[model samples]
Target: MKQIQTDFINKLGIGAFAYISISEFCGLFEYVFENILIIIKTEPKIIIWLPGIMSLILFTVIVIWGIKKFNKPIEIDTRKVLNSLIYLYFGILIAQYLFIYFGTDFLTEKYSAEFDFYNKANKGSLMLRGYLANIPILQFVVFGIILLKNRKTVANNV
Candidate 1:
């Protein structure tokens, strides 16, 4: 039981860490790559990009660490780690959507100014937003079910 708990915690921690690292790296890359014209025009100080460079370095280190930890020939499968991460991220996104659907008024009351800005910035029909938000969840669920159903066959084949 303790070992199971430890494994669960490790999976969750690694999933979150990897997700954050990936997001930061991608965001920094997009900003730097897509805004090259604006950046050159502005002639901003080199220090302006220091944080992005640091984020990229951190992301590289995380990838190296993950590769080192998981590349060994062991019973632990990287696919399992990916499944856990997908489940976790989807679960969180679903919960957030639920909160937005049901608790918007309460949140607006509690965080009047900020919530108002958020709502305005994300202006869209609730029905459309709900459909868009649910599409990936549905796809993920279908993919997850297919993976789970074929897990044994996949393992045996491997």
Candidate 2:
């Protein structure tokens, strides 16, 4: 039983770390792609959308897995974890909106005549990217807190 619990915790830790790292990488890739679009004067809608969607999917999978694998029915604080997940989702939505609002410039500058659209779109996209980049770090902190609190409880029980 003890070994099983330890294994579960370790797996959760690894999964959480991987999710955060992947999210960061996706953000970096998005940033790079945005710059490339600007430099090459190419409108890459597919490239821009892919990373965002992939990150969202990855995040969902990890969160669900963590809940199933790490959560203890008797002692785990499900409310806290759920709340954090909700907040994270909200952040993602806000980031997406900002990205779309600001990112239109890449499309407009490259393919349209609206400079104002470009300015608004690029600014929004940059802001959204920054905001989205922070989410993985926030999630890491939340998971760390959960682990620490759980450990404290276990220690108290022992």
Candidate 3:
């Protein structure tokens, strides 16, 4: 068992078992497992086959399939790839925030008669903000900062 696990992790290089892929795999697995457990304990019949769990499982399957079936890998170095991916994610988040801020008049307009779509749009934007705010992106950013700070420790250990 140990050998098999070690072999699996060893083979799970940056290609298929990239950080994001592994994170998705673990997240979906935990979500499905915990959700099923909670449902079984409480309301087993309720939401047994909800679209959310199904979609998460499907996404996990797709990630695994892409990693296993496709043998492609990073053309550049792993560190460079990681750096680029992190920067790309940061850029995407910034762009999304900009779009969400200025893309609509909900944030700027007064709640007058002309703002008929105010309530719904405002609620949706609030929900979106809450969802984004709850994500672990900040945690990852902190982890990166800590890792950079402890770079000398890692070099010494190596």
Candidate 4:
């Protein structure tokens, strides 16, 4: 049982690292896409779509891997991970929305001649803003269900 608990913790750590790393990469991609739009004459939609799609795929793979690795019959405390995930998603939603609402005007006013680029960047930002806004609420619902299952396991163990 001790060994199982240790293994579970290790797996959860790896899964958490993977999840956070992927999110950081996505954030970097957002910044890069915005800057690149300033100098390049590429299609903003494709630029945004490419990174978004790749990140989604990476996130999906990490989730599946985590599920397989962390599968244990024994009960584990999952509230920390669940709450952290919920809060992280919520923070991202708020940041993205704020950026969309305020960052566009700021960028355009400050950049002047680069207004065109700012506009393009704003469009890409808006797309992601919309996407992230829904993620936290949906995740909260899903995690809430999983928490119920976890509670049952904990009760059985007790």
Candidate 5:
């Protein structure tokens, strides 16, 4: 686990992984905030985007704090391993979407009630949703493969 973390810091040449973390944080944060606004009537639909802006500010502070406090290099260990946190992140994301689809009354709400999932009218909107849903999973898979490759080569060689 620590080996995976360290390889990320070294390969990125200064914690570029933090940006990915921030992006995932923002994505999930925005989704949750939007769902909340859906449940509680808000004056303007623009309220949904407020979470993204605030989260970006908060994430900026975290990255700055990390830079100032925990900039130590990660020691690469030989045992190839996986980070469970990555799986948990994606699991939470899938669960969140499932909750929105079934647990929440979002579909019945007037804002989204009009859209017909089976009809061809909302293809653009549906396509956008599909893209958004797939992006994180695809990113995680790609990075996981890269990390695994790096770990095997580095750990075995040393």
Candidate 6:
């Protein structure tokens, strides 16, 4: 029973790790592009490369940490981790859509005139944002494939 609980918790940890890794990968690019001028002005050419370098470091750290945590008493099962990751990915999207729906409704009621006008004009963009926010999940699909392919080596190393 305790082992089952531990494995459940570990799967959740792996899901969280995957989510954070995706976020970091997306954020690193976003930050670098957004601050390209500031980086160039304040630092050298090498500094521009720092974001990529830092992202690599962060990716390595997260992978290592995930492997260590997942390789616990029962051994690391890639399938379970993958399932957890998929569940979490969809769970977040569902929750986000619910929030957007309810929030939009509440605000529309509160400020019917103002919100109605803006909402009508930006309806497409608002829907786009809702979908785009979860686009990071695409990267996680690649990550999942990598994990599945490397399961043998990962299990042995564990």
Q: How accurate is candidate 5 locally (lDDT)?
A: 0.51
Pairs of colliding residues, candidate 3: none
TM-score of each model, paired residue for residue: 0.31, 0.33, 0.31, 0.41, 0.45, 0.35
Better of 4 and 5 by TM-score: 5
Give lDDT per model, in order: 0.50, 0.53, 0.45, 0.56, 0.51, 0.55
| Model 1 worst lDDT run, 10 consecutive residues | 38-47
Question: Among all windows of ten consecutive residues in candidate 5, which has the lowest summed lDDT?
Answer: 76-85
> Which regions of candidate 3 are displaced past 4 Å?
1-76, 106-158
lDDT of 3 by residue, 1-158 (tens): 98666544444443333555444544444444433444344333222323234444455455445434433442335455555556655555555455457643443353233233333334435445455443456435544554576566544542
Candidate 1 C-alpha error for residue 30, in Å = 11
Task: Put down candidate 2 lDDT per residue, 1-158, tens digits, no spaces.
Answer: 98667656654655455455445544654554555454554444433454555555555555556555655545544345444655665565566556657765555556554433344455546555666566566555655665575675445543
lDDT score for residue 134 of model 3: 34
- Model 3: how far residue 150 lies from native, Å: 32
Query: What is candidate 5's CA lDDT for residue 95?
Result: 67
lDDT, candidate 5, residue 147? 51
In Å, residue 64's CA in model 2 sits off its true spot by 14
- For candidate 6, the 10 contiguous residues with the lowest summed lDDT are 39-48
lDDT of 6 by residue, 1-158 (tens): 98787777776677675766455454545444424433234333333344444544455556656666755556557557767676766665565566557754665576566544543544445444555444445445546765786688666754
TM-score of 6: 0.35
Rank by TM-score, highest first.
5, 4, 6, 2, 1, 3
Best by TM-score: 5
Give the winner by lDDT: 4
Mark the regions of model 2 whose C-alpha exceeds 4 Å error after superposition.
43-158
Task: State the lDDT of candidate 5 residue by residue for 77-129, as single tens digits.
Answer: 31222233345456656766786787556555554533232223334454445
- How big is the RMSD of model 5? 9.7
What are the root-mean-square deviations of the candidates from the true structure over C-alphas? 12.9, 12.3, 14.5, 9.1, 9.7, 11.3
Question: Per-residue error at 151 for model 1, in Å?
Answer: 26
